[model samples]
Target chain A: MSTSFLHSFQSEWLKTRRSLAAWLVIIGGFFLPFIMLVGRTVYHEKTSAESTSPLFWENLAGQCWQFMALFLLPMGVILATSLITQIEFRNNAWKQVHTTPQHFYTLFWSKLMVIMVMVVQFFILFNIGIYLAGAVPALLLGTVDYPSQPFPFMYMLKTSGRFMLDILPVVGLQYLISLQFKNFFVPLGVGIAMLMLSLVMVEWKYGYIVPYTYSPYNFFELRGSAMSGSKDVNIHWLALSYFAFFTVLSFVLYISKKEKG
Target chain B: MHTIEAIGLTHHFSKEIPVLENIEMRVREGSIYGFLGPNGAGKTTTLRLMLGLLRKQGGEISIFGKPFEKHRTELLSNIGSLIESPTVYGHLTATENLTVWQKAYRCPKNRIPEALRLVGLHGTGIKKAHQFSLGMKQRLGIAAALLHQPSLLVLDEPTNGLDPGGIIEIREMLRNLNREEGVTILISSHLLPEIEKLATDVGIIHRGKMLFQGSLASLLLRQHQASRIAIETSDNAAALQLLAGNGLDPRIEAGCINLAAAEKPAIADINRKLVQHGLDVYRIATVEDDLETIFMNLTNQ
Candidate 1:
């Protein structure tokens, strides 16, 4: 990147401090793991019995993904993306940024990069939370011995990386919609409505077309459920394609807009 | 040389509704030019077009002798603007807000404190901009515009909602910037008296057309030419005849004998002649036209 573009990116990153998106990342990351930790401590006998299984770590990860992929990750992306994009609109600062020395591409890509980086930061926090959720129970309950199975660092990272890819289309679509409208509820409402539609169409033959369904469908497939639509199709590639399409379309529309503010 | 020049600028929201028409404006270097217009006279739109905030649908804008569209980024490095209301990030403190622009402008970090001090906001410390009073927020906006130390400053209605004291403060600051820093300023307002106080050059725009553009002295000269004298005497018909007979070209208008292009000395001479003609001059008032009256006359035309 050019120095000016890098500077624009740095400015965009600093703008997110104390923002709602920042809070969403922190709170969303710890939410599920904290719940899991609480549930295991309250029901130690069940957790202790479950820990004896050889797939203990894998089972715990699956449980986390059950909530995350179906709801938490998608909702987190929707809210965080909208909040970040709304910063300029909320403060009435879009015209201000446009008049700056930075180019149109710099403003567009820098803000998008900050949102994407925040998503990555969210994933890192979630992974650390997952580790704590699994380990805290083993430490707190004498009846629950540490799981005999080794920590699945590689498996956890691989699964987290896949989940990140699965949700990119959500981030892209939400960012695009958010940038177009000043009303926060508009994008949030669209995301919620699409997510519901995606859930209803998950079993349909062409459910892969709705990018929102990728997370839930990927989770169900990983849990050994029968893949809907074509059995040989890879939804990750579909997810990536949808992400690229929305990203490019939004960029074109944004820079060409006559009255950006 | 001119710091900014716009030629044949025209814009319309729709084919049937034109906002600006064939407008030409020249803002010279090291001069404070006040852009004057009533509400909806296309002042803000013209300023937006000059700064490239809105796409120019017609005509050319050049700043520092280069085409605005082809050399926008380079020209913008030396142009700072505050359009309409102040744009302040509610979540960030005053310092943080300037820091954001400091990074974008790639200016020295030290300029941030200097800018804050320039705007009397250095003492604000950690107060977020949303909490600032309207005047303070406007100040902070000006400070942000000055952060890059641009040679040209474009401000739209900078004194729109400021209290008298606040207006005075901003006026003095603009004067100092023009005098000390040699920064050219193009500030717009509907208030002629306000512009009369600060503007070295003035442009009066009305209904999407440039009515008058020149130095304040030339506009005052136009005001001088437009001045009139009004006389009410005991015998109004006889007084009109007597003044006209004396080659004063006086006529009755709105129940008074009026003379066009009358000067201060003409007021005394006309009064003395009326008394000598056995007509009691009840009142003789020299209506010296002000800038506001001149603005009204031009806009009315």
Candidate 2:
């Protein structure tokens, strides 16, 4: 990290400590996987008719991904960005920050960097949570050949890892919207509206190209087949393209934008 | 050296009327310079321009004997500002909020307690700022601004949201900082009397133009020496017409009528003329003008 970026990150990180918004990322990470565990247990209890179910983990994992992709991930990004930036907006601290020695570039990008670090931390904990959510419970129930099958560990890991790549660009978009508005509800409303729009248009042939719907397609369409532990950049190149375009535009606008009353 | 010098500052938002035009202000080092103006008289705009929060379009600003824009980064490290509303992190404790700025300003940790104590909030332990009253918040804002011990403190209406006692506390604190620490303060206020007791130098701005900028002692000399005759009348229009018909220029203000010339002969004579015109002359008194009257005379004109 450059000194300017480091200085900004230090301030950003200090503000995040014990902040409610920053904790939401951890809660969201833990809560989503914990819900999946409950769903799996209920599914396992209802399946006495079949001798054994092959689709037990698959269906549960699929549902978890669908929820994460469509609603939870997008909403998490929205809330996190707004609440994080809202700390500055809440008491009108932007003037002090503006008058500081820190340049707009360092301040803007450093915030993005903090959000990126937070998202990565969330993704890692989420991956570990989901893995334990399935593997630990399955072992206790003697439901399936756990040690013999060794628990599709790589599949769970890859899917969670894929969630990061696909979801990060989503975070970038929310950061742009969140930083522009001092009112938290404006960006939050826009985020929810876009998420709803993404869900409505997910079935269109070219819908995956839409940035909001990209995660749903990537998670749902690719969760089943693309879990082959293969690298495919084309899966989210469009989301990445949008992320890069907006990130640049956001930086330009932020650096050049003169503050006003 | 002038701590802050804004020469020919011209600013406009879009093609609208210029908010500040050709404003040249000078603040001497170690002097509490009051940027005095009525509401919407561009007091806030001029302070923002001085702090480089607003872009300088047509003028040069010098701070600490150097061009402001050129040495902004280095100069900002030596300056602290609270513009309009106080900037505070409400979620954190008072100590924690100061800690956040200590890192930003790279000041030592001991200064946090010193600042809080200076603001009369030293013992409020672990209380988050969200629960603080408005006066406490304003004090905390001042504490945060004072955290780095800047050479020049630029505050825009710092006493706002503070009560009478809180206002005095801040006024005393600013004076102490100026006297003991030699910290130069540039404060903006719409109320002349409020700044009258604090500022060493005063700049009266009205309608984006500076009406007067000089030492407070000099301004006060003009204020105290100003003598005006005020007449309370039953019918102000009749009294004004009577005074005008008698070659006296009497101006009506609020309910009382005032004449620029104040003398015992003038006071006795206006009373007689009003009665001759069948106007009821209530009480007429010759009183010394106050700072508010001086400011009104300077800015209202």
Candidate 3:
């Protein structure tokens, strides 16, 4: 990277420290896993018997993602992206950043890169949480037998990778809208509205066009509960396409905007 | 040499209303240029255009003898500005706020405390900007602007909300920056007295037009022209006619025959002429024009 770009990125990175966006990442990453750990401990008798099944690890992963793919991940993306983009607006600092020596490209992309990196951090934390949730039961309670089936490391990694791709369009669009409006609610409202619309149209044949449905549908398909129509569409490729289109559109609009602040 | 020059700058929000029209401004190197204007007179717009915060609708802006648009990033590296309000992050301390810009300006981190010290914010340790008073926030904003040590400083109403002491502190700081460090400044404010106290040069803008632009001495020269000598005469009507008839412009203002501030010899000549015309010149006194009056006259014109 150029020195200017590196500096811009570093500056943006510092802004996220102790911010609402940072808190959201920490809390959002661990909330569901913490709940699962409690749930498994509360009902160890039923879980210990099911632990011997060959599908034990897969079932546990599926259960963890059911609500996550449906709401938490999508909502987390919306909140995190909006919170990060709104930092400049909240403090009335856009003109300050614009007047600096950095190029517009550096300013725009460095912010987007920070949000993306935070998302990666969230995923890493969530994965660690997931591992602890699965392993802590066997380690602490003698009554609970460790799952006889080998841990599906490759399957888990692949699922996490797919979920990351599946959520990119939501991130791209949220980042775009958040950059345009100063009121935090506008982007947050638009994201929630779009996610709701996608959920409503999930059974429609062309529902794959709505990028927000990609994550949830991917989860349902993996769990064999997907509607037959979803099998015909490659949601991942569509998500990638939508992500690229929105991201480029955002870049053009932002750099060309006359009144940035 | 001119540190900043704007020629024929024009902008309009709609076709019906132009915010700036055919503006011609120049800021000499090492000189403090006070951009004097009232509210909604496009002072902020012109500054925004110069700083590239607003896209120029027409004309050209050049700083340091180069086109602003073509050399924006390079030019901005040597230009520090605070437009309208202080844009400090309320979440960060003064030092951290300066560090943010230091990284962006690619300046050394040690310059942070130096800048804070210059703005008298060096002692604000770990206090978030939101916790600071409005004056303190404004100072932090200036410290951030000064972090890169730009050669030219463009401030739009840097003292808008400052108290008397805060205003004096800013004025002194700016004066020292110009006299000692040689930083050219283009500061905008509607406070005529404030500008009068600190500006080496003044540019009075009103209703989107360049009404006057020159040295403080030249602007004060117009202040003399704007001032009037009021005469209480026995026949004020006759005195008005007598002064106008002698190739002098005089008018009745507040029941007194008023003539533009003139040389001592001219005042004597007027006195003799009025007395010769059978008019008793009861009293002759100079009505000193304040800076606001001069500003009003220029902008109103």
Candidate 4:
């Protein structure tokens, strides 16, 4: 059983690795954050605000979250999810896989594991891109004094960590959507629409319930602001709860539904 | 020990319409059982039900003497199948396709090359399945089915897209597998001639009903009386008159007269009568009972 599961997992990974969409997601992971960092650097260089306070790092992390939620993370999730399901739909490969002695859970989890691994890899690479984009330029040009305190390493780490944690809800939701929808555009469109709606609600006093709104909220200290007052709402917990709930729900649907080859 | 036994098996896609009705089939341990049918004749549905691909609405299916639904993995482990078209990753090469299934089946590493060679696709390594012709793809499909040295191989339309050479090659390969390894095979095809060549035992299905099921000899014997004798004569008018006068109003074809009879003496009598009548008996021969004829006769009734 273990051998069969491992083999299925290996085959699923090989299929993903060979996909053009997987490569695109990986490339976008590196490219998007680099572009953000470069833009921040050029702006900082022009303004001479190089590392003005811990708020600078918080602001940079906010930018990263916004960029990822808008395109990078959703694209990565779609690519990974579609990579697994499309093969079955296109070639009717599930019939062959199901005919083997391997159990259904083995096949299901193998494909699921591949998607999870890809999402994790995208997250790590995106963070690395952000670190390089900001850190390398700061070192090259040196930190400049500004009106507030300088950006600290602890603040940068915390901000990056927060951004990574906030995106989990989107990843989980996209995973569910991709599994359910055969049309590629549906998930992409739905994700973008939800993100945009959350962005719109961010300005309202009650926008803390909007998942993407809280995604960028924790990165910076609102400082007696209305958004800060809603900190007790804890977007991290909401995100994690949503992630766990939907992941289980999607898994149940997958296991319970009679798979048609 | 039968490789497969489905007793009173029934299934339906919708509640009102049953796709398979009280299907009782037994595939002998090591024989090539041809599952004959027309389109939508429940051949695929029967295979699916036996393999536990679909939930059975009635009755039980056992593979190698164990219930299939209750012990699906164990039963499936010893059986390999190609349900419809070849289910292989087009992006992967032939070797990669085999490797994927090999891993899934957890078969011995040594069997991969042997399976490929058995299907006569041994040397086309690294050629992606998309690059293969329909014939190669079908051969690859068979190789995948045979990868685990399965005891029972169930294939549906295994030779659908093959050229004449490919068809002959697969027929020979299947015969070898049955003979050399003693693997039992349950194959389904609409082509009667192909099944007639490969099947030792036969099951004919029409419109979701099992019309006949038995050894080829038994099936042939059952229709032996329905067998016809054809005779060609220089004068068709005189031959028809001679045959009718003897109460053997033969069925007429373009250049021959056909009479349904089991006894050669009756045909010989008709031939001798024709010759004596100066009808010039050109040819007198017995037409062997083929599956097509039996299929037509069975389904028509």
Candidate 3 residue lDDT tens string, A102-208? 88999999999999999999887887777777778888899998888888888888888889889999999999999999999999999999989988888888788
The segments of candidate 3 whose C-alpha lies over 4 angstroms from its true place after superposition are: A47-56, A137-152, B233-252, B265-282
* Predicted candidate 1 versus true structure: per-residue lDDT over B209-281, tens digit per residue: 9989999989888877787888899999999888778887888889988888665676788888888889998
* Residue B200's lDDT in candidate 1: 93
Best by TM-score: 1
Which stretches in model 2 have alpha-carbon errors above 4 Å? Answer: A18-20, A40-63, A135-157, A225-233, B228-286
Comparing candidate 3 with candidate 4, which one achieves the higher lDDT? 3
The deviation in Å at residue B86 for candidate 1 is 1.0
What would the per-residue lDDT of candidate 4 be over residues B10-98, giving only the tens digit for each residue? 77787888778888899999899999988899999999878767667799888898888789888888888988888867878788788
Cα lDDT of model 1 by residue, A178-241, tens digit? 9899899999999999898888888898988889988898888778894575256788898899
TM-score of chain B of 1: 0.94
> How does each model score on TM-score?
0.96, 0.84, 0.93, 0.84
| Best DockQ among the predictions, by candidate number | 1
- The TM-score of the first chain in every model comes to 0.96, 0.83, 0.95, 0.72
Q: In model 3, how large is the Cα lDDT of residue B102?
A: 92
For model 1, the stretches where C-alpha displacement exceeds 4 angstroms are A140-143, B253-256, B262-269
TM-score of the B chain in each candidate versus the native B chain:
0.94, 0.83, 0.91, 0.86
DockQ of 4: 0.51
List, in the given order, the native-contact fraction of each candidate.
Answer: 0.73, 0.59, 0.72, 0.49
- For candidate 2, give the docking quality class from DockQ: acceptable
